[model samples]
Target: MADPKGFMTTPRQDWPRRPVGERVRDWDEVYVPGALLPIISAQADRCMDCGVPFCHEACPLGNLIPEWNDLVSRDDWRAAAERLHATNNFPEFTGRLCPAPCEAGCVLAINQPAVTIKNVEVAIADRAWELGLAPPRPPDRLSGRTVAVVGSGPAGLAAAQQLTRAGHTVAVYEKDDRPGGLMRYGIPEFKMERRHLERRLDQMRAEGTRFRLSTAVGRDVGAAELRSRYDAVVIAAGATAWRELDVPGRELEGIWQAMEYLPLANRVCEGDLEESPLSAEGKHVVIVGGGDTGADCLGTAVRQRAASVTQLDIYGQPGADRDHEVEPWPTYPKIYRLSAAHEEADALGTAPSADADARLFAASTLHFTGDADGRVRELSLVEVDAGRREVPDSTRTLPADLVLLALGFSGPDRGDGLVDQLGLAMEPRGTIARDDGFATNVPGVFAAGDAARGASLIVWAIAEGRSVAAAVDRYLTGSSRLPAPIGPYDRPMVV
Candidate 1:
């Protein structure tokens, strides 16, 4: 209500990204620093503050979008940040990384462009950090009840922070040498800088949440022993078993999984590694699967100065514009997306000529042709039919010195010693099966995030973690006071 006619007066303005040529030289984030603050207030004013905000229902965390929008429009960034952090534990992460389904579900989007909720969120969070509003909230008193949270991703971190504030002693266990799971390792630095992840981790540590890095529960300590040592155990181990393209010549020296390639690039950016083992430098790279992972690889390869890059997808091409008939307003549309990586690649003149980001739809890989030295030289492919069957007459070969299988993950790796030692029951889809309360078949052990749910958004992971913590808190105290952001059966609004 800052301005009743604000929506009509101001049009939605998106946050500006850095110049493609300048940003590609290094691993800094694509967004230009201090670029959004100038226009963010006008963008925030565009919020309608609807009678029944659909954006609330769209967000898993039930973020106070309208309230914060009003606060930001009035130049009250401190209050805006407070309102944002009231529900979401880490707005900085989600604001930068999340696809912003809430904007799709906005009431304004029914007619005009939606409010720039994501940009406003980032502005609020950045302002909070500048003003020192984002301080640690250590609990006033410790409950003396101990909780062991396994995982250092968004879910486990949110759960640990919430439980710690609820007066419980919490310890977060991460198998990796550093914390932040996928955020630290899986995500590229150019997409989201590591400083953002580290700053949030610093706050969490200050809040009395103890972190045990490089210590996996099932490996370092027995799963049963971990359960016995703590009053409650919450498992937030993410889904990491990658889905592979089972075709001929899969064992070639240059053919690698996306996880193998992406993490190495990330580690190199962190200065922890000398060089990536599967670098695309001076090589023609072919990425199979046209998802976010593929786009990430495309950008990384371009940065590494790949000789050429091509991406393939089994599905048909998506419409350039939004499809109103198939994917209507108030829901996330199935349309062509031009991510920051795509923009950078397009500017470099190395992008594919298909009017998109080096993507070839309705294409399936046949096999890879290898050089005499056992390294991949080229990839054999064919046009896919309506049923995704390869057509014989449309066969072709593309030169590729390196091949990355960006074909997404299946679920958590069951072969990991942790799942076997815990004897956790898994559903048919390979996800750990939890009861109504997010408790597994075991009495006191609970599961959450990508481990219980399949591969999902960071917001969903945090919501699941918060909900599972409430369930564990109630189980320990008979009755407890904690916010359950989502239930066990809850799915994302966009998905």
Candidate 2:
């Protein structure tokens, strides 16, 4: 147990953020640097170390939450780091980005606020890095077998690291100029700095994982040739195909997909360009889709000095607190809570809660209008019911100098010809299909991450990587020692 009476004695506290005025001017992370460290141990003590520990089950990575919490409370950061790394390949990414479903599954949430599990997790990982406890552990002997991993994102990186440490010569192929896939480009730097990703990649290189960037699999190298060269292949290629809105004027000049806009901004941050070609500067922006991607666009646009920003969602706004009647305890709920991006948006004086002005709810785009130059100028919207039928007399239009479709991704990119060349099976949802062991129909070929499970969280992607690595190890040498944390179809029961 963490602390005998800590739950009763202490109340829950949130990670503090920087003053909105100070943070928005710069691209640094929203949190106050080194602020959480002072209060982390007390927060870790709030974990009850329950008999069931539902937090473990809730986490897709199967993280040893209670064990790490105990270690954190005991001031044993080294042991906490080991426990965290035992299941999760990347806590730093998740700690900064994951919604913390573990907290929703915490037993403490039955009566009181859940323990600050996410804060403790980040604290442990950061302390380990500061103390140099995380070192590259290269294998002493090679297995003489070679494996090729496609896509250098979380799943591919996790699988590559595991295989390389197990003494197999593994090579990672990335079509982009650099690795990290969405982590590198899809995500903005204000949420998490690039240095964290760089330091981790450096460790992977030290551990003997080879990377070949700007070299695609099916285009540059034939799929048949790749399969013949390596003993096995792992496809961790994430879902990158952006979904489109089939409304009128969608083909206008100023309309762009969220992926098209977000990455260009990220490149500017990376010093790749002086300014983004699709910069939202001095424009009124309208984003369709009220999920994280939409929130991301809102923050990025505000930073770029946009004249105005509006986010639209078809679904009704959820309550400020969890609706226990509909979504009971121990299950992840869709309640309203402010994310760092949302907080930044709130600071911009957008509608406080979800409404028609800023974070509009129950709104759907009916059509769009454009100018003589074929550039989008305004958007037509209407209020809808649960069945999606329009509410009477609710049609309206908003000035939209630039329109962004943050409407999420469909599946992995199939234009590269890997799917056709390999003859891989796809699920109904457009993701690659795999069996119980994360193996494809073709023997020795496996899939993981968004390529197999469709678009999902980074925690789930890393979990799939660890699980598939174990399956591949077993297939290679008949049996293996690495832990398989999840089955092929295993997933969390949340939205």
Candidate 3:
């Protein structure tokens, strides 16, 4: 249980970040390198190791947080890494990207700051890489079974790795030029560098997971042919259909979707493109969403030297601290968060404009005012009621050279024709429907991750992948030894 009184003796300390000004000018991660390792062990020592371990309940992967906290506190890094890998397939990714619901569910958080679980998890993973502890564990023998996995995102990758190790020949198909799906193209470089994604791909390849990039299953290859070629098929195609705002002048030249803008920046980072078509350089950018994607756009535009940046949200601003009455502890809180991008934006004094970084909470876009050249010049907005309905006589206009619709996704891309060709059923929400085993109406064809569960966190996606792999293994072999970390219909306690 770590140190019996460690919680009392050592106060919680988190990873330190570089000065916002310095980090904004570069593409490196926001945190200071090597800054957390020195204090992480002591921070791990502060874990109380509660009897129930609500953190396990909090994590979708059901990670053994207390055990590893004790292992790390004792400086048993190799063992800690092993324990971490026992449940989570990509702690490195989640350690960086996940919102850390486990920390919110920590017993220590009931009174004080939670243990630095996310930082310690990343440290253990990094140490494992340094010590050569992580190695490919390819199957000893092929099972005479082949599985076609569509999508190379975290969920698809996790399922592929698990199925490969379980002695199945798994082929992953992606429409992008490279694997990693949204991880490769949608995510900005400053938040999480590509090296982390590449290393995992290397490990997956060594474990015999074959990848076929730039191949859309339903388009390049017929869905029937895929079903006939493989013993089973797993659909992990993530939600990529960006939601659009249908208003006047929606097709203006300078107006774009967040997905359209973000990937171009990522492509530039990959050296595939010298310049992005949606570059915000010297432009007045206004993002019309308040989620992580919008923050990402804010950061990327700042890096691109946008003359000014503003973000708008339909909902009112959340409180700075947790709202215990509305959202209790051990559940994810709907509090205001200052992400690294927000910090960087604030540091540049490119603060949201008077309408605040020009946010008009409870506001809705009315139309786009454009110049004669067909370029967007300004945005017309109207005050909205709690229901997001436009209120009368509350119109306003704001300068916006470039307007990015940061609205969230609607569902997976249907352009591939797989859903229709395979006769798969979709929920009313546009998400693919799957049973408890993640199996579609078509037999032997399973679904996982965003494809099955809709847009969600990377941790949930990976967990769903692992679970679906177990189900697929069971379907193939009648009985299996693989772990079922989650069910298709199961949602996190918070979600």
Candidate 4:
């Protein structure tokens, strides 16, 4: 346990982010270098020695929150890293990207601010690398079994790493030119640097995990061939079939999906393009979504120097504090919270409203208006009530030279021909159908992550990946020792 009285005496302190003015000018991560290490220990000390740690239950990966918090508070960085890695395959990725539902479940959060779990996790991850605590551990002997992991996202990578460490010859197939999937192309550099991903990839390579990049299964190689070649196949292709806006004039020239826009900006950052042709510079941008993807678009537009930016949320703005009756303790609540991208938009005065953040809640899009050249010019919208029913006399129009639809994804993209070629069963909602053990209808074939679970948080993706790997290992050798955090049907911690 951490300091017994520390929770009562110490207040939570977060790692300071870099200044908005300086951070917006460049594409580096928004964190102040070397700032987290100094403050993380004290923040870790704030973790109570609660008899029941709800934070552990809240995490999809079942991260050892209390154990790591105690280790970190004691300044045992190495042990903290080990305990963190015991459940999570990629602490650094989750530490940075996850919304930290665990914090919401923190025992201290009942009356006080939660311990800085996310910050402590990241500090241990970075310190582990610096202290040589993290090293590639290749298997001592080969199991003579082969596994093919489809996709290079979190789930696929986790599965491949686990199988490789268990002595299986694992090969990861990625259609993209690089590994890391969305982490490489969809996520902006400002959120997380590519170096962290690159180093992890290096470690995987050292551990004998093979990556077959720029290779599309069912296209370059038939799904049948993939199944015939490998003893087992794990499909972690992810849910990338982006939802489309069906409003009128959505086909206008300047309209794009968030995936389309984010990847191009990421390509620019990767030196593949000098500058994005779809740059938001000098344009009035309007994003149509309320999720993290929309905020990502907001940040990217702000960086590109968009004239003005606005994010429309279909639901009404949530209250600043949790509604205890609706969402009690240990349950993740829907409350107003400012994100880094929103902070940047607010600081730069790039949002439509000067006082509030970039988001306009209860706003629903009616249609878009285009110019002479068939380019989007303005957006028509109306305010809505709790049920999304339009309110009377609330129609409005906003100048929108560029419209981005960040409406989230429905399920896995089947355009790659993998699903059709394998005759895989899919749910009505478009996700691949799988059993409790992560097995698809086809024998020796499995599906995990967003491909099977639909779009979800990064932590869930990694958890599913690790779980699928255990099932695959058991199928391959009849017995295995790999850790499986959750089954396919294990739902997230929600009310």
The top-ranked prediction according to lDDT is 4
Which residue pairs clash within candidate 1? none
lDDT string for model 3 (264-368, tens) is 999998999999988999999888988888988999999999998888788877777788877888898877777888777766767445344434577778899
Report the error of model 1 at residue 428, Å: 0.7
Model 4: residues with Cα > 4 Å off, grouped in runs: none
Cα lDDT of model 4 by residue, 1-495, tens digit: 667888888888998999999999999999999999888888888988798999988998889998999999899988988999899878999999999999999999998989999999999999999999889989999999999999999999999999999999999999999999999998899999999999999999999999999999989899999999999999999999999989899889999999999999999999999999999999999999999999999999999999999999998888988899989888989999899999988887787552268988999999999989999999999999998899999999999999999999999888889999999999999999998889999999999999999999999999999999999999999987998988888886666
Model 2 worst lDDT run, 10 consecutive residues: 349-358
Consecutive 10-residue window with the lowest summed lDDT within model 4? 347-356
Q: Is candidate 2 or candidate 3 better by TM-score?
A: 2
Tell me, by TM-score, which candidate is best: 4
lDDT of each: 0.87, 0.87, 0.88, 0.92
Candidate 3 global lDDT? 0.88
lDDT of 1 by residue, 1-495 (tens): 798899999987898898988888889988988889999988988999788999998889999999999999999988998999988898999998888889988999988988999999988998999999999999999988999999899999998998988889999999889999999888889888998888988998888999999997787888889888999999898998899888898888999888889999999998988888888898988899888889889889988989888888888778866677777767788677889877776777664533366777788999888979998898988888769987779888888899999887767776547787878898988888999999999888899999889988888988888888889889888876888878988875543
All candidates: TM-score: 0.97, 0.97, 0.97, 0.99
lDDT of 1 at 312: 85
Q: Give candidate 3 regions above 4 Å deviation.
A: 352-360, 389-394
Candidate 3 global TM-score: 0.97
Better of 1 and 4 by TM-score: 4
Q: Count clashing residue pairs per candidate.
A: 0, 0, 4, 0
- For model 2, what is the error of residue 95's alpha carbon versus the real structure, in angstroms, after optimal superposition? 0.7
Q: How does model 4 score by TM-score?
A: 0.99
Cα lDDT for residue 330, candidate 1 = 72
